[model samples]
Target: MVTRQRLRRRNIGILALLLAGLVCFGVVEGVALPRQDQMEAQYNAAQNSPLTHDIARTSHYATRYMGNASKVTGLFRSLPLGPIRSFALDPDVFTVQVNLDASAPMAEIDRDRAYLYSATAAFAYIDNLEAVIFNEGSVAYRVTREGLLTWYGLDGFAALTADSAVWKTEVQDKLAEQDYARRAFQELFRESKTLSV
Candidate 1:
């Protein structure tokens, strides 16, 4: 009782369904998938910009010494009182006010907070100091010290406040080392730029 006309019509319907499924799949794979990939790439790039990362890393590493009050005290302990006082008064040497990014990671924020707190506490022993906080904790004064006793306890301020010239040489030597490190960092950054490009 089977008819050729009915069989042919049934086969034509099956072919039409298969054709529609193939078209839908092609649109999804060819158009939607590429668009999705492009959006993901853009999101990733925004999350991790190379320049921002490099700046943050450099600042964190370069300023790590500011977080250790004891170390800072030790470094300047042997310095002569006159040069120490002069350095403290020098606007170009001790004037520092850094505004950290609020969006930075918690670890980075904590490090910044520690540096500010330790530096401020250590420098509070200085006489005639004008340390001010303004703009909702966004600004502060330079770090320096002159007196013998701090709020925490006695630092190495006694020897530093005494007469000495050897410490000045040591300080200058340390600065030279830091300068070398900075130059090396710059060279590495330039190399990275070349590689990236």
Candidate 2:
């Protein structure tokens, strides 16, 4: 019973409404979803990355050593090889050097001394893993009597060899922790997205 013009108008109205809905959906998705996905991807990449973890840990230890003069010596002594562990994993990527002043304060001297011990222990640790310590200084310094004396004096080597099993266990534990953190972050991210919606 409708006139032709009326039917045409109704069809045009329906088409316009559909077009508006499509534009609204597109605008919301284009503005929001891509940005959210990008952010999540970046967060996941950083959180799950071993290099990132290593850099963070190295920075943390370095900051701790630099900030706390009272505890620096004891902490360094406790983790003699910790300074070089991150670098040891990729010799080709890193060039490490230790410059120590014999006339410095006891704390400074202890820190440098600890670093030297770490360098030595790192050499041994990498060598044990069948990787060559290509740094000439690393190779040459360890051959001298002073180096030998330092090696014999510290319990670093003994600890490294004796606690090899513990090191593996610790790595596994760290992986588990990372996994847990990643899951928690993912849950939080999902919650944030839901809240935003």
TM-score of each: 0.27, 0.24
Backbone N/Cα/C clashes per model: 1, 0
* Cα lDDT of model 2 by residue, 105-144, tens digit: 2342333333333433333332222111212222212222
Supply the global lDDT for candidate 1.
0.34
The top-ranked prediction according to TM-score is 1
Clashes of 1: 1
Please, what are the lDDT tens digits per residue for candidate 1 over residues 32-138? 99999998887545323211111111121222233343433333332111112212222323322233233432342223333333333334333333331111123
lDDT of residue 94 for candidate 2: 26
